[model samples]
Target: MTELAIGHVTTDCAHAADLAGFYAALLDRSVDPGATEFFATVGRESGAHPVLMFIQVPDRTAGKNSIHLDLHAPDVAAEVARAIGLGAKHVADFAEYGAVWTTLADPEGNLFDIGTGQA
Candidate 1:
């Protein structure tokens, strides 16, 4: 048996609610408001155990993120475009193991990768 399981992934951003809303719309999930206006959660209503949480921070620096999310989609191109429409910026496209993936950054400049569901 696995000794540990993920609880949740927390993202620090300038605007917690806005970041949470962006992910909620992208994932087709909903945001659960936190105790204060500075925090919020995405994917709570999806019945998923590990959700995404957004926390408000004062400063947002510009640099490559040490950690990022990797998402899988049935239609890679369409999903990447949809995320772009939701304010994500396209970084690049890459291929590995005969599969294609796209890199993108959220409004706050957090990086994440999206891949076609292929082996």
Candidate 2:
């Protein structure tokens, strides 16, 4: 059997550098110096087991994102507020599952989820 080891996930973006910087700031990590026009990686030493990779694309994104990132927070309400203040637009709110999660879209229209649960 072949063991699978996850290293990183690269998300496609219309503006590579700009989107990469946004994530870098959000995640509080610097973009890898060796990164190129195609991709950027962050969270190399933030104590988070996993890292994020933002990939650049030439075309502009349109419509809704087919896939999105789901984030966990201890305080969903507070986190959602913070995210909104950071240019994220609210898409939906579901609070009946003993958990509150909000879907949001970034400046490039890519969707990501933020909620309270897990670490």
Best by lDDT: 1
Clashing pairs in 2: none
What range of 10 consecutive residues in model 2 has the weakest lDDT sum? 42-51
lDDT per residue for candidate 2 within 19-109, as digits (tens), equals: 6676676555677666676767776555444677778877756777676778887788887787777677889987765866888887777
Q: Assess each prediction's global lDDT (C-alpha) against the native.
A: 0.86, 0.73
lDDT of 1 by residue, 1-119 (tens): 87898878988898888888888888887887562348888767666768898888787666898889989998989999999999999999999888889999999899998997576
- Where model 2 places Cα greater than 4 Å from the true spot, the runs are 34-38, 45-48, 59-63, 96-98
- Global Cα lDDT for candidate 2: 0.73
TM-score for each of the candidates: 0.87, 0.76
